[model samples]
Target: MSEGSTGASVVPATVHLPDDRYIPVRTEDLVAALAREHDAFGELAPRLAHVGEALTRIVSAESGAFSRRIERAYAPFNPDRETVTVGDVGGDRAELAAILAYTFDKANYDLLEDTQVRAAIDSANVHGMKVRVDREKVEELQIFVRGRTQETRLVRTIRRPIVGEMREVELYRRLAVVFRMQNSVEVNIKLFRDIPVADLEALLPHAEAGMSNLDRIKILGGGIGAIGGATWKAAALLVSGTVIAGQYFWALIAGLVGLSVRSVLGYRRAKHLRSSQRTHHLYYQNIANNAGVLDLLVTSIGHEELKETLLAYALLLARGERIDGADALSRAVEAWIARRFHVTLDFDVADALESLDRLGLWADRATMRPLEPEPACARLEQHWRERTTEDYHARTLSQRG
Candidate 1:
């Protein structure tokens, strides 16, 4: 029952994924691409559409169930909830965290370890600001990121303190964080988009931003210049001897006091500017919060599940003889995506197989072959019928009781 420990169902480390688990193509687009590559897919296009629809329904059902589980677990900590519940708050909080971790995994997000978070803060980011997170104030913290892509960004150079455009800048397309404060047991959920990997520390709730080394140097140099100017003016006044002794003394005092005030004001202005920059960066990145975060996560889970299922089945049908096992199928899918969409990713073959197996489309487990498109569509329709019938009976029984 640690921070990220979910008892027997611990989430696996996804650090091996080069990009992310997300398939960067739409279902329809994927089908179209497959048809263009394989003539058989063009002939079975209608059946493939049917299979896609059926798989979507199944994934949607699973997503809805998981969403309910998350909402129930999160009820106690939901800040926007109107009702106050009287139960074991601690137990509810742990359950919420566990469900959220699972949801993040299902959504194909990679959990950021403490070490990784620290490393990101230690590294330089596009924004020239030093960020520090107060770990002592945090009772629990979990960060999950997904859709990592290399992008171009303007970053401050270390050698000359000049900004330049850097290519292949890694960034997380989506970021989700769960945080609980030491003083309060209530959990906080936050979701953001387009977070630079090096600036991940800035997303923390208790993160404090300070002026970078370059900014500090500028402030220090300005203060030194002000002092030098004040000293020169004082020396000039005394050397000229045009004013009386009391007048010269007051002039020196005024010059020193004004310099001190100017230095303080300059420091404050620089600090405020750094803080404003951090705020502006985050303002555009934040996407959702609290219950809204759960909704987005659930939706994402459904989308990822559907995409994986479609790709796996399509690959199996198109190249069933070539695929020897799950690994081979994964490679085939990955290669196809790289060739077609120009994106490389680590496909979650296990999850895809599980979905196909559940839908009864997986014909041979040993060979990793799926049923033909026409038969697969029929089987999925039958499965959907059974599911709907079971739901109808369950609802009927509940209403009667």
Candidate 2:
């Protein structure tokens, strides 16, 4: 069996399933493995390839419809596109809000929960940059994340600030944030890659880097210390009566002026450091924005749907009799994936079954069985013929008009 990429380790006690729906195995390799394991499927390799192509077409058609809906809803809010002079954006906002959740799910991304958002904001970042977002300014906010992985990252320690130690960190391979400001015309959409969980706040629109308590204490303490030292020196000069009165007054004023300048410079320096950290964090992480994010999401939906359909059909064909119901089929497929590919994932069995049913490949719904390879191929070919015929008629009508 050709091995697939390894996923998160599965422990018997906890039995945690990854939220991501992405399959690590290549489609062709998976088909070949199924054929090798089941001799009945050996001759159906070509048919299986045809099934994949049919499914891809179906997914693409559905994704295109969704893309159109998203585009219409996003037309007014798209930051990259030119502004449209709409009397009221309320309708557009409503449409976008209605479909945003479904769109993210179709794209195989999990919504970041409110609790997770709060945790990210409350926790300190490994990079030591504190960030704050003005929640009142945000009219709408949604964050979607996919492909969670555990990785070791170098984190700066409080004691050893320079040479930080490495620690295990959970990160999202992709993050999409949709933000709309209160009383704003355009909504902002941003896509980022490989974002650390604790640094999610930094990716928020208009997230500002702020001085930490330690930074505040350092600046306040330094200012106080400097003023105290100058005050003591001035008192000594007054008591000794060695310096003239005018000279003493001038020296005290100069000391005060120096202190103010130092304090101002210190604050600016700290502010600059924080701003630089934030800029660097975002520059490396951001991957896409606005209309570009929508394009990527539409493509992801098609790919994920295709993967789900292929896996579900192949499993049903190879082990139809053994699987009794949807739950049983799901478990069977999950076990096979873990055993064959060494990857633990929660197969989206419902969506897979729905696709098969729609394509007329599923035979017994109760048994969760699909049609035999030959019959399945015939059904898929028929679907293609119908789809092409419909397209042709539509094009003819448009041309005639």
Candidate 3:
């Protein structure tokens, strides 16, 4: 099998690639591998190409040799030996969330046949209580546990990602309707790289609508005519030249060929777009197990679309905060506030902001002003310190023994 590009001993698996050769894959490829076929790990590769320069630098370090080369970056990805923990603010939360959520939501929930989120949501609603989570810890996990619903003695946490800016609320709403599944599931994607709460929430509505349309226009659902035309053009090009010039018949062929080329290109664009939506879909479906009565509650209020929109928006709002009151109320509160005052608050609220804080709902602190993001993130200035001090000391002790 292909060796890990990061030079660590490869995980035991069977494949046809050379024992020493590494096959790096795009992050998207890893995601697709899991969604399409979980066991098809051999096909997925780390998106290590961009990091080639970084890897080369590490390999050249005096402490770094062939043994430690590719594995440096790979260390973050290994669950068994984590370089960062939930308490480590600088831990690659987004990637960790993506991989783990898929396991929890898909493998544990769907494929493995464990928790049924729809049922969990219901049980939690009936007997659920809310918990108050630490602000700094929430940043560590990149999730604000809005609230929880206890069912079968299990606390099912409900939450939403905070969209830093209020203006993106509309987008969050749209995303809820189109891609609300992300919220409904159990995977906590603390955050996407550089996709702040505001941008996601702002673009949510459009993203949702567009994704929904895209699904219909591609994948399992789509506009058949558009897709079919593209496929035909692609096929024709594969067999012949981009431009066919010759007989009168060739001129006629040219017209068809033009359509074919355009169609294939369109199909590819649609396919690429479709890939991201699948992640959102599978991700949400996994976490939604405990959305609580929100889904039914919204439906009862005759606001199914609104409710869906709210779910995605809600997750966007509570991304980096902590709300641990028995259930999803904190997250719900965050949603209500966004819907009401259109602002986000931090955990360190003064007594004066009480009414303003509670009026919005959820476990939020009072904002200094609208549009300014509270320092919800847990700073990781000590990451390298901990790496070199704590971990390195432990490694030394272990080796000495």
* Reference-based lDDT, each prediction: 0.72, 0.71, 0.27
Best by lDDT: 1
Worst 10 residues of 3 by lDDT: 168-177
Candidates in order, TM-scores: namely 0.84, 0.83, 0.20
Residues 310-401 of candidate 1 have per-residue lDDT tens digits of 88888788778888887898998898889879998899998888778667786777777788877887887787666743232124224544
Give the 10-residue window scoring lowest on summed lDDT in candidate 1.
1-10
The segments of candidate 1 whose C-alpha lies over 4 angstroms from its true place after superposition are 1-19, 35-37, 40-42, 83-91, 124-126, 158-163, 235-243, 388-401
Model 2 — TM-score against the truth? 0.83
Between candidates 1 and 3, name the one with more favorable TM-score.
Answer: 1
Candidate 2: list runs displaced more than 4 Å: 1-18, 24-47, 83-91, 124-126, 217-225, 388-401
lDDT for each residue of candidate 2 in 1-401, tens digit (9 for 90 to 100): 00110111111222222387666666567655654554545565456766776666666666676677678788877778776556765555665765676667766788877766775666634266677888999988888887777787676666545576666666778999998898887888899988776677788877888876667778878998888888887877778776585598678879888997998899889978988877986898888898888888888767777778777787777767777778877887788778878887778888788677667787877677788767877776777656643232123224544
RMSD to truth, every model? 7.6, 7.3, 25.9
User: What shift in Å separates residue 277 of candidate 1 from its native position after superposition?
Assistant: 1.0
Q: Lowest summed-lDDT stretch of 10 residues in model 2? A: 1-10
Model 3: C-alpha RMSD to truth? 25.9
